[model samples]
Target: MTEPQAREIIENYLEGYNLFDVAGMLSCLHPAVVFENVTDGSVTLRTNGKDAFEAQATKALALFMERNQSILAICLNADCARVDIKYFAISAIDWPNGLKAGAILQLTGQSVFTFRDGLIASIQDIS
Candidate 1:
């Protein structure tokens, strides 16, 4: 893929995230896609394949009463992209020891995307 094509894919994925559109997000990923999520320098979640990703995405989306991902910067080559985002969300349910329902959360994060066959093969998110 060209650099712009890679960037567009990333942008579309981000848009899906902001919209809580699991199908839209999955469309940008390869069938065997891998996803890793890190928070505070620790890996919080990991999943492989479209089915696993869809399950996680659905669960994660349900926890957010409102969510938005605002892209701060994007850098891309032919096969890789890095997206910096300002993320905001409000909890829809209470956690065991985390935020309560309706609590607002904000974080800055980066998602590194790897592409193969014109689709995202993997994504590693760090915040």
Candidate 2:
């Protein structure tokens, strides 16, 4: 797809995500969408298809009281777009990892997106 088209799709998805709106996010993804999360050079999570992705997104919706990912930059290639983002959030509750409720979390990350039929087909998030 073209750059602007791809960017608009990505921005739409992110807008849904930042609002914890799973339905809106899923509207921008292909039916067979695949999602992966990588941390410290290792893949920590993988979800296939829109259903699985929706489930994960729903679960994550409760992880933070407020969260946002501000796009820092976006670069386009033949069939993929990479987005650099700054993530900030306030924990909604205590976590097993010792992150307590009300704690502030911040990080920088990149998300690589690929599209199919004008919708996002795959996503790899790295941090």
Candidate 3:
């Protein structure tokens, strides 16, 4: 796909995620996909295929009592992209993890996405 088309596809995918629409988010991934989440100093959550990835997403959703994740900006390169996301994730209702009310945890992270045939073939993230 063209760069603009890929950007739109990614934007839509991000929008779907912020809305907690799992199905919508999964639609952007290829059948044979590799998703890597590198957080907490090099441990990776790797999933093969869309189904596996969806399962991981579901687990993450279950952990949150409330969450609102937003994409601040997106920059697309040749077959790669970076997105700045802002999010508010709460583990449980009325359980404060030292976060203030209405506080947005600003995350300036980047993910490299490789597309094959207009679908995401690989996604590697770092914060």
Q: Model 2, 5-66: lDDT tens per residue?
A: 99999999999989999999999999999999999999999999999999999999988999
Clashing pairs in 3: none
Q: What is the C-alpha RMSD of each candidate to the true structure, in Å?
A: 1.1, 0.7, 3.4
Q: Comparing 2 and 3 by TM-score, which wins?
A: 2
- Which is the leading candidate under lDDT? 2
**TM-score of candidate 1 relative to the true fold:** 0.94
- Tell me which residue pairs clash in candidate 1: none
Instruction: Looking at model 3, report the run of 10 residues with the lowest lDDT sum.
Output: 93-102
lDDT of 3 by residue, 6-105 (tens): 8877777777777778888888988998999888668467899998999998877655556665667777777777766665665542234575544445
- State the RMSD for candidate 2: 0.7
What TM-score would candidate 3 get against the native?
A: 0.78
Instruction: Specify the highest-TM-score model's number.
Output: 2
Better of 1 and 2 by lDDT: 2
lDDT of 1 by residue, 1-127 (tens): 9988898888899889989999999999999999999988888999999999999999898798999988899888768888898999999999998779999999999989999999999999999
* Candidate that beats the other on lDDT, 2 or 3, i.e. the better one: 2
lDDT of candidate 3 at residue 117, scale 0 to 100: 81
Compute the lDDT of residue 95 as modeled in candidate 2: 96
Give candidate 1 regions above 4 Å deviation. Answer: none
My TM-score estimates for the predictions, one after another, are 0.94, 0.97, 0.78
Each model's lDDT: 0.91, 0.95, 0.74
